[model samples]
Target: MTAASIVDPMFISGASVWPLVEGGKGVAASNGTSAGAWAAAGGVGTISGVNADLIDDNGEYVPLIYKGRDRKARHEELVEYSTKGAISQARIAHELRQGEGRIHLNVLWEMGGCERVLTGVLEGAKGLIHGVTCGAGMPYRLAEICARHEVHYYPIISSARAFRALWKRTYHKFGDWLGAVVYEDPWRAGGHNGLSNAESPDQPENPFPRVLELRKMMREMGLDQIPIVMAGGVWHLKEWMNWIGNKELGPIAFQFGTRPLLTQESPIPQAWKERLLGVAPGEVALHQFSPTGFYSSAVRNSFLNELYERSERQVAYSDDPSDADGRTVFLPYGRSNHGVYLTPADHARATAWMVEGFTQPMRTPDGTLIFVAPDRARQIRRDQADCMGCLSHCRFSAWKDRDNYATGHQPDPRSFCIQKTLQDIAHGRGDPIDNQLMFSGHNAYRFGQDPFYKGGFIPTVKQLVQRILTGE
Candidate 1:
């Protein structure tokens, strides 16, 4: 019952592993290099988000060679890209397999052709990948899919209740092959957070009791021995040692998200790494403005700053004519200029941008757009037409097929295309301020309190894992 009595399990599902898990990040943050480094340290590492097919010929990312007439004829081109990427990642893991650490892949549940993409990676990566982690929606069939492929499966969840639902309906029979469960703090994690609108964004519950409850639920279902990986805002291990060896908590583990981002091998832009160094505690915020409709954490980059400012000045409206309705009205861009309410400063900024011909066009769910730039607009249109149908209802495609119902609302300008921003950031876009949508944990400010990290030195995966494991 005591925190000191918690037990940190060495491995999950009979696989050799460390107590730490290198949390999977999307858009190339957690690549083969970072994952390989973590696996080399005897911990589990996950590479995720459309695993880059960028290969090295002589220690450099090389372009694949393909000949095609049209897009369909380019099938071989895309397949070659995917194969090269999967192979590079597998080779990296193989190089570090001697440490007896486990290697895994985390795939987003909503990504297009999830089954084919995962199967491709697994088939290409046969012996190297030990497990698969999935989240961002209930992966009801993931257990069966991974089971068929003979790989362990971990479903990332925020609450014990959600796990119970999944177990009863899907994973309960899988038993030993179920691997470990990852409990990511919905309010404090980077990337797509799992919190719903009903939950209080400002108040986060202490994870210790929540995790214990998860253990108890697992016990009731005859799954008590499974490890629970704690993720989100986990930095110092010494502070968490108090939870080690606790009986009520059962087998425990920790997954680090933002902390891993500062590692030298992490494939993020240098400017982004430097930004995290200067972040103060409470500087990172959990906001619910993502196009995916999920809450995510990030430092106040220029993109986020503009979003926050616009939201703060946002006024609500109702159809009632009475002023007593307490509803304010807003005008659609390029519509009647009157009755449009905006803060004086915001109005001025919008007016200036418009006057300078920097117009904001409607955006699609996939982030494609018809902008003023003719060439760029053409590209956006092409990209939109080439939709992989990644999301259930892509706002970009204006694709809606639910009972033939339609919102008829155009794409939102308030939100930028996630694919574009994340891609740019991952590929080393120099403008950290303008282009990238950086994600971080709420505890990012603590970096300033630690004297050893003064002015920020990018630590390698080995250094971070060692620090956490040794309770430093």
Candidate 2:
């Protein structure tokens, strides 16, 4: 393959540099060390602001310990830790860069206490962070926050409709500080995606059309000069030559979230990096199992498979016998509750599952009951009881950050605690391949075919950047 001339530099955050950026990976995957090196290579580097890791003055990793009597207290502690961690990472990234490239901090708008954490980090870090990139929700207040701090803001969006809504609602006033709009493909992106109900996960749409549509909308709104950072499924610049210098699309940049995982500077554990080499095509699955109630893409490993099985073991139920689709059947759950009403077929299925040791029946918000083994049921209850309110609203724990602080429904058993799993995977506290959520893009399988990674060769951040510029 011939290397394309990627000499067109773009100005972002007071610097004109290569229009390439490192997409932020959360839960300690993208840290200060890696982001700093990316910026040093003359590209935008993104530091994850989702419970980022921090180090002590003695050079030891500071363990995040939450000692709260309840979820509210734990949430407070989480925000404090998150803010401090972001500030620490920003300092380290700035020091390492020494004023080269640009450093952007990424956060999820759906994350618990988002406002508090954003304010805290921006207040503490000050000039260290040049821009803030937010995704996973319609962050209407992000522009205002960035403007107040005199920092640039990039709102990660999936559709033109979403961007228009943001611009019309709150961003129009602070339009100058609006750095760029990141159009992360919801169907193919790693981590939690923002696919609405109108969009089907089974059918993937072409990003070019979607992005071009976005540019059209932006131009109509007088945002013609702003760059659109295309994220998700972007592996090579050569493949995207048509998007480059296209007057209709305007200024554009590419954000890589998966390719950089194998770099030497990547903060993920060695085992996780090695696992990437073995990923084959179609190994990644996009599903709605996140506690945040949003669809996320991840490797179909043991952890994801277990969640699938748990959901499969579920059956809908009714409070009265007559509501059981006319043909009423009693599903004897436990010795005390007697059982709920179900159809004859469902009753037989439930009986079979119970015989197979799935004796524990649990209620869900959608008038369904999922049966699991006694041990698994106990674990689920424990996890729910130990909810830390990591998300603004959790499907697994039914915990909300506002009002009564409850979803007013039973916690669903199909989902698991995202915070617990992400923390475990990031810290290498358990099996890397099994037992934890492994966020990845559908294009992750290309790792095996890429010649740059032939014979299990892992490159440094600088080497990876140079190779990418070669249009490989």
Candidate 3:
């Protein structure tokens, strides 16, 4: 390794490029324009293959509109739409890179019709996408798909055990196509996190030990030269000097998720970019509100506050009016007056919330009731009704993509429709930066503190890459 290892280029995905990687953000955040510019800057650029956008004749993004009449039909339409968009984005990225750097596609394993979309994109955009990085589920078929397409596969995992399990179960058969293992620190990363049941979201563990463990396990598996991309909470390369030349870990790389959001090539709206500049410490939160049932990090705003408040205003319930404790009170259910019983103390709390205008009590799959304002309840119902089946199984709408097209449970009022909000925010519909779901890394406050972004100045992708290479 060179003394100036931070600026040294490392080979990745059949190309010699900087170890810096752009982690893909979905719903039009990191698109072809941004990914291509990063690739042009001589780094691995990842395009969000999840719900990519298409351009119209005027060189503007075409609004995603569904023509299907029902959830299942709409899901099929979504799959077809995503394939075309992915192909278009891949071509654009390939053109912009000019064959200088590799362009990787990022897709979620649990996204609706993952297999069909991957098949269509890889077949439709042959030789354009060099690799595919997948997370959010086991994705046992990812290696097989990438192998068939003649592309590399990178699996994003939180721990060494997860990677070991994946390799033993299926990836071992396609080891030749294994690109690298992305060790994304679940507590600090933006978007959907990979935190397991044993990990506490409040107590973030040191990523150094985790990455070291992963590298140790990889070496034992005869994968010493395979690069490990350290993601999440990584701000400056200078702060990570020890990891570069350490003998314990070989061929290390870095991935940036939130730092690139302020670049000119980023596809997110101007309002969203501006919002990042003013973010303060503790403004971003790691919460579990996604319909996919994964812990995600997002900026704290009215949108997130509403969800937090709903969970706070919740109480357990029972069907029997007379409980064994003999201190039960009943709350009517949508004119049925069904004996939904609650303890006396809980009843008092619910009555107080009702008097405060939280009259609507919605039942969740967990057998708990969340009290929300009537307007909010109606909006939730409306959003649930407009489900497009973007996820394989959504708790918000209880719409499953396969089988009977339902999760065999009622729509969860505790969750919100992620598809609608992500699309709306990306389209800048009504400038919903604060009103819609906004994902960000926990280190977002660095944008406000870093002198590099002083005076609300936004840099181009190339300039940002150069700045990062300087270890700042």
Candidate 4:
């Protein structure tokens, strides 16, 4: 490949650095150490703001423990903890960068207390953070928040339609501070995806056309010079040679989320990193199981398998017999006069599941019930009861940040507590391999075949950056 095929150092939102960037991962996956080293390597580093970790005065990590008795109190503690953690990470990253490169903070708009957490971090870390990259919802207020902080803002979108809606609604007024627009391929990206009802995960489309659409929209709106950061499904610079300096997609940059996870400076546990080396093709599954009600891509480990099976072990039901199928039978569980109406076929299936030790049947908000073991059922209930308002609207617990803090629906047994699992996995507090939510992109399997990582060599952040610059 020609030298021009590789990305050259350029100015991005006022910071001069290599166009390469480390995409943010949540629950402490991408932190001060990783982001700092990446920036020192002359690439843009993104520190995750989703429940980040805090460091003590002696440079020791501080474990977050909630002492509140109720959800409301715990939620308040969560906001406070998140804000402090973000600020601490920013400081560490800034210090490590030593006035080189740039650091950006990433947050999910659907995250609980997002506004409060963003305000606290930006205010607490003032000039340390250069930009804010946000996704997972239509973040209309993101521009306003970044404007107030005098930092650039990048809105991660999956479609041109989504960007158009944002620009028309809010981003238009704050165009001066628009740093860049990120186009994360929903079906291929790791972590939580942004696939809407119009797009199906099974029907993956070419990112070129989709990104061209985004560029066209940006050009029409007078944002042509602003770079469009292409995220998700990106592996190496050589594979994307045509996209480099393509005039049709002016000022394009590539963001790497999965490739950097195996570097020496990556903060993930050793076991998690080893797991990445052995992943096979098609092992990562894109499914709708997040409490935020968004599609996410993760490894099909036992944790994901259990959730998939839980949804499979479900049957539709109705409060009134006449409202459902012709066969009406009282659900032999719950209080008297609270029997649900179910079909004869579904009743038989439910009975068989009960005989298999899945005796506890829990109702979902969508007129269905799933059977689980008694202990599992108890754990689900406790998890739901101990909700810390992690999301603005939680599908698992039926919790909302506003409207009296309730969604007015029965808790869903099909979904699990994301806060508990993500925290558990990130901290390595439990089994890392079998029963944890491991987020990854579909192309993660390439780790095994990539020649740069032959003999399972894990390079340092600097080495990795140098290797990437070779157009490998």
Q: For all the candidates, what are their Cα RMSDs to the real structure?
A: 5.7, 1.7, 1.4, 1.6
The Cα local distance difference test for each model comes to 0.68, 0.89, 0.90, 0.90
| Candidate 4: residue 382 Cα off by (Å) | 0.9
Stretch of 10 with least lDDT, candidate 3: 1-10
Model 2 residue 421 CA deviation (Å) reads 0.5
* lDDT at residue 172 of model 2 (Cα atoms): 97
Model 2 clashing residue pairs (backbone):
none
Instruction: Residues 254-294, candidate 3: write the lDDT tens digits.
Output: 99999999999998888999999999999999999999999
- TM values, all candidates: 0.80, 0.97, 0.97, 0.97
- Judge candidate 4 against the unseen true structure and give its global Cα lDDT, from 0 to 1: 0.90
Prediction 2 TM-score vs. true: 0.97
lDDT of 4 by residue, 1-472 (tens): 3464377886776877898889999888999889999899998899999989988778888887889998778888999999999999999999998888889999999999999999999999999999999999999999999999999999999999999999999999999999999999998999999998988789999999999999999999999899999999998888898899899998888898998899998988888999999999999999998888899999999999999998899988877775336548667776666667778888899989989999888888777888999999998999899899989989889988876898887778888899998888887886556699999988999999999899989999889888888787
Q: Give the Å shift of residue 171 in candidate 1.
A: 0.8
Task: Please identify model 2 stretches exceeding 4 Å from their true place.
Answer: 1-7, 335-337
Clashing pairs in 3: none
lDDT digits (tens) for residues 151-193 of candidate 1: 9999999989889889989897776679889998887777788
